[model samples]
Target: MKRIILVAGATGNLGNKICKELIKRDADVKAIVRATTSLEKKETLTKMGVEVIEINLSNIDEVEAACLGVDCVISALAGLGDVVLDLQKSVLDGALKAGVPRFIPSDFCTNYNALVPGENRNFDLRRQFKTYLDGTAIKASSIFNGAFADILKYNTPILNLKDKSIGYWGEKADWKLDFTTMEDTAAFTADVALDQNAPRDLQIASFQISPNMIWTDVNTATGQEFRMQQLSNLEDFAQFIKKQRADHPAGENELYAKWQQAQYMYSMFSTQHARLDNLRYKDLDWTTSLEYIKSFVK
Candidate 1:
């Protein structure tokens, strides 16, 4: 029997990569996408012979229909609105209704229990969302990648390297930050999907790199000298951003907008201290190095 896998939010950057990687491995793929989303991804998925289904993940019945006969479901839903709950509800209801065996929730950052109640609203919601999944029969889990290695392209004021300056918590020295590239994460996810007896929560870490190391490596790779500046703590960093936003609310510079996204990054940097102990995936020999990330850097 051909195993069927459904990828929700399949048009997203990471989600689409997961679909393509799964297809590369010859697994039957069903990509669940919303009508409002671009079909450019749908076309690419179609070219790869994936079944692209246009379904509103907010609609439980419709999502259930999409999951029919699906052996595994992977969700990469973005945003922090109630849409998160809606998508989860839809996936859970649909999976149970369709008898899907496995589910990988839209969790790709932070260890689930690491969040302090008041720190990050988005991470808190995801932790709660994962708990909801635990109450169901469909085996489900999440991936805790420290941060997306690709996000370095954007120059957030806090961690802006484009200006020859990088800000981080603690001392100005190097500290390891575990990063997982989209491709490595997607490939590991495919491995998880293929393993019939794998545990509910499976973690796949590509690299534990530090900002100082990243800058040094980038400088060596591109022959461009850069500097890294360390900030005291997240609260101090938040205050700096708060003052910046207050002074220039409508600044044309993109870093102001990037600051909003940095909240998640800072939260990850603060709480991603857990030892990932993913010996289960050690046999796969899945590793992503700075050499692998060279193309992703700007």
Candidate 2:
């Protein structure tokens, strides 16, 4: 029998990709969306044969109703606040009430469990949610796929293709960073959700390369010599996080809060604390950094 999968945040970047993957697997897929979601997004999912249900995530009863008959629940919420917590909790509660056997939270980033509280506020939220899940009867699976490989294409501090430069937070350029494209992560997530024997926690990566290696790839792809920029030392990065926290405080400036969170995450990536489980998914053809860079840099 085909499993019924309910995906929250189905309109999001990762969520939508996961939905498409599940559809390709011929699973019975459903998406829980808000009434205010765009008509185009609703039509897009509808055309993909996904059952779209309009409901507010804040309403526990409505969320629970949506989870009825679902074999698994995949949440891809990409927000930073108490609302993310509340909505996901509602989904968990509903999934449990509906007797759904498996739950995958919106933990698609690095191994947040390895970091301490206050290192990154966004990661802390995920940590808190994991703690909550520990006390529940619902089986939970969290996927940590390092950083998204596609982030390099954007004008982030780390990779600036237009400026012909790659930046690092620490003096050491040899520190490895793991990355996985959202498309691959989503496809793997769908497989895991359907696999009854999959573990509760999984870590996967597309490529694990150093700053210098990334720069070399960019240079090779674009045919330009991209200079390396050392943005900050470890100490200075810590201080910057402290200053951003002091300047923004909690619930004051969302932009600064995100900036501080991003800096903290970059610092964590430099340390490479997360244990990757990429080998467990033997069938996945992971994208290499060079290939990914060449796809968009030129």
The lDDT of each candidate is 0.72, 0.82
- Runs in model 2 deviating more than 4 A are 250-258, 273-275
- For model 2, residues 210-251, the per-residue Cα lDDT tens digits are 889988888788678888989878778777777766776663
Which residue segments of model 1 deviate by more than 4 Å? 37-39, 157-159, 238-259, 276-289, 296-298
Per-residue lDDT for 18-113 in model 1, tens only? 888888778999988878866687798799888998887777788889888888898888765455676677777888888898888888876657
Candidate of highest lDDT: 2
lDDT: worst 10-residue window of model 2: 251-260
- Candidate number of the best TM-score: 2
Each candidate structure's count of clashing pairs: 0, 0
